[model samples]
Target chain A: MSRFTKIALIGLILFPFAFLLMLSLGKQWPYPAIFPEQWSLSNWQLVLGGSEGLGNSVLVSVLLSLSVATLSTSLSFWVSRHIAYHPKREAWLSLAYFPYVFAPVILAACLQFFFIVAGLYGTFGGVLVAQLFITFPYGVIFFSSFWNERLRSMEELVKTLGGSTAQAYAKVLVPVAKGALMTCFFQLFLISWFEYGLTNLIGVGKVPTLTLRVFQYVSEANIFLAALASCLLILPPVALLWLNRAVVFREG
Target chain B: MLTIKNINKQYKGEAVLQGLSFTLRAHEMLSILGRSGSGKTTLLKVLAGLETADSGQLLLDGQDLSPVPANQRGVVYLYQEALLFPHLNVFENIAFGLRLRRRPETEIKEKVNGLLQRLELPGQARKMPEQLSGGQRQRVAFGRALIIEPRVLLLDEPFGALDAETRRSMQQLLKRVAKDFGLTAIFVTHDLKEAMLMGDRLGMMQNGQLKIYGNRAEFIADESTGALDEARFWTDLQGLKLTK
Candidate 1:
């Protein structure tokens, strides 16, 4: 890349984080001043030191994101095989995009009746199922490209080598596909981490994720706390994005 | 001994293999020559159970193998492209079959190392497939398939991707490997010289029909096999007027 392009990209990334840091530190600096009148780490202390139950919110967010990512990635890895190999795979893949086209909040509202009937309303399971409808489509699209003639030849190689079905998957398919699986896991994790609308409607305000807590503070007009929570939510995804770039681009 | 009786295959309502029948003697390597789209690959796929024939009987040692699945067919088909497992190193790719069979580690190591030496790739045990040349990668694939002790090895233009020098050396290596292992093999190629060099018997296919020759004299003399046409072309060139 050109030097100017690199500088512009770095500036674009750093400018937002710099503003968030300023907002999280300054107590009040209304108007005309280009800089904060005064700054302190008091808000950071409150957010990080468990005074606002931010620690619990972070824990809940991490656990839910981990579960959702793990379940969706694993489920789709196997399920995509059937869809990819089907004769009508193109038609089926187009249908798979239906749930994701609608807004997540609208979809959650539409599915709330089923959740209530299944006795999952106001529970973590309800929220997880709702999130699944969003993340599983990503997995399907990501994995659909995996089934080509090369993979078929590899599978036939296994069978002719006296391998069974279980051995073909365990020995060949999983090992070859490991890199893609990791990429999918990290992406799904980030998706669930930043989600708010579905969780709020389904968790019924009981299961407070970090995103929900950030919005709550924002509504109460607590700029410092909201900025701090937003920073927490944004940092991991940024780190993961950088890691993914390194992994994919370096290999190619 | 292996026998294929009246194998028929169709694709998109077109006949790719029609009433194809041939018997391969024990330890015999049959080289098949055909024009492109002459169904050489389809025959191999059916023999390897990668594709099912519409109707056929495949017999090994007088027992029908028509009902067998691809994995249980004991037939290995090597492609024109050496499709080695990219995630595996040279030794691991060769040892894949043994590992799946749960062979003892010592046995697996001894067998793989021995084959590596025979294929002249001993120093490449730890190297990935991407790190090897085209010829070396094809050798590794050969070792990988040979280690399984398959009933029939079907080679589909195995040296088609190599440079001329590499192709010659690989052909020599394969000739030695087949002889040393007493392997029953079917070699397919569009190159007449390559087919003649590799096969104990020769066959030609055109428009999904095959004709095999048990004798080399008849195979070379047959006009439809193209060998006589090649000879006639050379003889006719000798009669051209000298302009210089």
Candidate 2:
């Protein structure tokens, strides 16, 4: 690619984020004005000060994504291994796709009744569970290809080498799967991080995750606040992408 | 001695091993020759406690091993692939079983280094599995298994993937190590020559049954074992060359 082409592509990719950052700092732009009449740190200040609750939203989103990612990645890894080796492997694996068959919003709506009865509706825990309905199965499907005959043999080898089942996982399988697990965690984290529909329905406006806040500000037509929320929303996933790239490059 | 008695195994209602019985004396390597699906691997897995026999008893030194779990059975099963822990280096791989036993770091280092030297993998301790050649990887695997000092070593076509030259060298190395370590092992292979070359006693598996030969001559004379056929082929080749 030419230098001009490269620069153009880079700008193309970065323009929206730069625009968001600029808009987050700008205010009082009249109609037909390309630039705002005034620019200040007030919007950022409001978010950081917790007055706008954007900071709280950020915290909630981070915590929820982290929990969902960690839980689902680990649970799915264990579950997928069993399913891979099970006699009815195809049957069990097909069920992991069931959640994805319907949209997350529809799935959440379906599960809302159960959540209400279980006293989880309109709560952080409820949203987390709802998000898991999507991310967990994704994790299972993601890790399904990882468990093969060689890995099964490796596990058996560990056993025959005087290592217990736990030791087999800890000493060999888990370490061997470190890359896959990290990749799965990153993907699942993103799934939970940007998740909107399920969080909206299940949270019932109680769990104000950053995604919800972004949409809230957008609907309210508060462009500056929305931009700020959007910036906050992409931070974790961007950081995660950077980290994942570094890991993958180093491994390569 | 390791004694296998009336071991029967079935997969999907089809018998894989039918009343398979064998007696292996201490320090003896019994090589079983069979084609694929001949129940050779099933026999080894059953002995290693990786697979349970439908109705059989595995007696290691006259003690019942049927109830023991695989880890506690003191039998190491090696596959055709080296199956070395890719995350670990040569030294760590060799020391894996010892580390599992929670041996002292000094002891582990000492034994692993010594085994590395014995495996002719000296100065290659820091190399990862991916860095090693196929034969080298197998040697590391053998070192790993031997470091644990298992009661029986069950090898299922351990050198099946190696080139002819490497396979021969590996066979020699295994024979030397087996004698020096006084290792009692069951080496399963499909290669006719490998079965004869590696075994102190030979057995042939056909239709889920194992027939132990009384001696090499008897094994060669047994038509069903294909020993005679292999010998005749080579003889015919030699004759053709002489005639030309």
Candidate 3:
């Protein structure tokens, strides 16, 4: 990158983070000061200390996101392999994009009655299902490009070398696609982690993820706590992106 | 011995392989020369069991192999492009078949190391496929195919992507490896010189049918092969030089 471009890119990232940190730390800035008049860590402490299940909410968000990412990514890998070369694979891919393109809040509204009847509404599982309905398609779309004739040829090579189907997956397919799979996993995790509209509608204020907590604090007019929760909400993906840059992209 | 009889295949109403038939004795190489759409690859794929022939009998040592799946058929097809397993290093790629068979580590090591040496890639056992040159990748692929002691090895234009010097060296190495392993091999290429140089017996494929020649003289004598025309042109040019 050129010097000016590098500076601009860093500024674009750090500036928002700096603004969020300031908002989280400030008691009342009230503008025209260029800095907070009063700063405190009380909001941060309150969220971290687990008052009204804040810490529990964070844990729930992490668990749900990780589970969704793992299930969808792993499932997509196997599913894409099977359907990739099918004569109707393009038609199937078009169907996969449908769930992703729909408005999540609207989809949630339509699915809410089914969830309530199934005894899933106001439950953790309800939130998980709702989020998965949105995120799983992303996984499918992410992996669709990777399942090609070249990969199939690799599978064939494995078979001709006396390896079984299971052996081909274990030895060749997984190893060759490991990097791309990891990148997809992280992406799905980010999608699930930051999801809000569907989680709110499905959970009905019963399941408390970090995004929900942020919204709750905002509704209560606690700006500092809201900002603090928002920062926490965004941190994992940022860290993951940085880690991916360092590991996968750098080596590749 | 390996024999293919009445192998026929069609795709979308177009015949890719039309009653293609051939035979090869043990330790002999048959090179099939053809244009791109001449069904050479389709024939090879049929033998490897990657593609099932619409009608054919594949015989190996007098046993019918038509009912066999690809893995059990003991037929290895090397693609025109070097299809080295990208995740594996040179040694692992070569040892892939042996490891799949659950062979002892010591045996795998001895066999792979021997192949590495013989293929002239002695110091490259640890390099990833991406790190190797086109020639090296193809050699590793050859070793990977040969290590399993397959009944027949089908090579589909294996050296087509290499530079001239690399192609020549790979051809020589292929001949040497086939001899050392006693491999029943079918080499496919569009290059006349490559087909002539690699095969113990040479054949030509046109419109999904194969015509095998008993010798180089016979192959050259066939006007449709382009060899005779090429020879006449060279001869006429030589005469002009003599007159000058």
What local lDDT does model 2 show for residue A79?
A: 97
C-alpha DockQ for predicted model 3: 0.72
Candidate 2 chain A lowest-lDDT run of ten: A243-252
Clashing pairs in 2: none
In terms of docking quality, how is candidate 3 classified? Answer: medium
Query: Model 1, A1-252: lDDT tens per residue?
Result: 999999999999899898988888888877898877889998878867889888788888888888999999988888888799888999989977988778989999999999999998988888888899989888988899987888878888898888888898899998888888879989899889989889999999888899998999899998778888888878767887788788765655
lDDT of 2 by residue, B42-137 (tens): 888888888889998889998999999999989999999999999999999999999999999999999998998899998999999999999999
Q: Report the poorest 10 consecutive residues by lDDT, candidate 1 chain A.
A: A243-252
Where does candidate 3 chain A have its weakest 10-residue lDDT segment? A46-55
Sort all candidates by lDDT, best to worst: 2, 1, 3
Interface RMSD, all models, one decimal each?
Answer: 1.0, 0.5, 0.9
Q: In model 1, where do residues sit more than 4 Å from their true spots?
A: A1-12, A25-51, A242-252, B241-244
Given candidate 3, what's the lDDT at residue B75? 90
> Which CAPRI category fits model 1?
medium
Q: Per-residue lDDT tens digits of candidate 3, residues A39-123?
A: 9988778777767577788889998998888888898888877768888988988888887566899999999899999999989
Interface RMSD of candidate 1?
1.0
Which scores better on DockQ, 1 or 2?
2
